[model samples]
Target: MSRLVDAHCHLDFSVFAADRAGVFERAREAGVESFLVPGTTRARWPDVVAMGAREDVAVCLGLHPCFMDAHDDLGDIAALSEWLDRHPEVVAIGECGLDARFADSWHAQWSLLEAQLRLARARRLPLVLHCVHANDVLARRLRQLAPPAGGLIHGFAGSPEQAMAFYRLGFVLGLGGATTYPRAQRLRRTVAALPDDGYVLETDSPDMPLAGHQGERNEPARVAEVCRIVAELREQTESRVAADSTATACRLFALD
Candidate 1:
């Protein structure tokens, strides 16, 4: 089978710090040769950049809403801009978006998201967005902006229509561990029905472990399982899912 991209992960995070190199090796052997590690806060950008420097890893720079306190001032935008300008290796503009499911500061989250969204558009980079319980606003903003560089809505768990909203606006859904759950009929159905190019496989590694691996640390290698599940849901073969999802991610991130 052709190699696949673990479209979203946090290998730089402490969870994999002890054996980061080993983690990549295992993933590579599992047929996941490329990885996209997105920044979650200013403090971790350096580590993320260092990881991105590797031949097989790509990175995205942005502040996630769950860590709203990390982006105190709008200064993060300036810093991210400078970093992105200096680092052609940076592939996308996010890991940023609203997290109404967990964060109490929804307004602050939206404000921060807007700043990054504008930066992403200005730089002509697709965004690696993370939205939880806030698709209405996310879709609305994207409609207004119409960014030329499309992106992935990572860890997608929405309906077919909701998934189509992003697809129509040049964004594709990221399918991950959630699809492995038997109870995730809705999400699985969405992945199965969406246009073949409208979704990509992600592990969201060091988090979102598959159903059987619950309570364990997720790694890029597990994305292969995600691909399998997506294939099963779509009633297609594993190889087909791998090739299609990889091509879609390559286009969105300019990973040529």
Candidate 2:
């Protein structure tokens, strides 16, 4: 397969602490040449930044919507702006987006998300969105906000129409372990239907384990598996999927 990129992964998470070096080594052995790691909170921004120091890794800093409690009294939005100013090497602004599952913080989620969207626009940086059950709302917001840098909707699991909606907004979808399962009929169809530049492959490591690997810690090396499944769904060769997805990710993030 052509060189691959993990468009989104939390390789900074403590779960990988003991063998993080091996993780990178294994990913490189699997042909994954780059990783985009997004920070989920202010607390981990430093670690995420440190991880980005690696030549093969890029990073994003933002307050994840699910972790509202972490941002609550910390002025994290302003801090995120400052962090971006200080870390010009940072590639994007997220792991941030609306998730309807946290009902109590629904309104707060919108508030924080809008702030980050504005930051992305002002900084002229792409985003790494983490949306769940809020695609319609997010699409509308993106239309209104119009972050020129455009971004990736990481771990996308929606209909073809939804994927097209994001593509129209200058954002590309990130296909991960979710598409490996037979149960994800709609997602697999979306994978087959996407335009040549409409999506990138991801692993969302230590989280969205691929089908048959449930309960195991996902890793960037598995992004090759994602490419294999995407190729099968699109009826293209794995090399083709790897090349197309890596190109899309490089373009979106301005990666070298």
Clash totals in order: 0, 0
lDDT of 1 by residue, 1-256 (tens): 7779999999899988789889988998899988999999999999999998788889999999889777864788889989998998899988898888865788888888888888888889999999898888899999998988989999999999899999999999999999999999899789888998998899998999999998999999999888888888899999999999999999888886
State which candidate has the highest lDDT.
Answer: 2
lDDT of each: 0.90, 0.93
**Poorly placed runs, candidate 2 (over 4 Å):** none
With candidate 1 superimposed using the best TM-score fit, by how many Å does residue 13's alpha carbon deviate from the native? 0.2
Clashing pairs in 1: none
Residue pairs with clashing backbones, model 2? none
Q: Which ten contiguous residues of candidate 1 have the minimum total lDDT?
A: 68-77
lDDT for each residue of candidate 2 in 218-256, tens digit (9 for 90 to 100)? 999999988999999999999999999999999999899
Please report how far candidate 1 places residue 46 from its true position, in Å. 0.3
Instruction: Kindly give the stretch of ten consecutive residues in candidate 2 with the minimal lDDT sum.
Output: 69-78
Q: In model 2, state the lDDT of residue 24.
A: 95
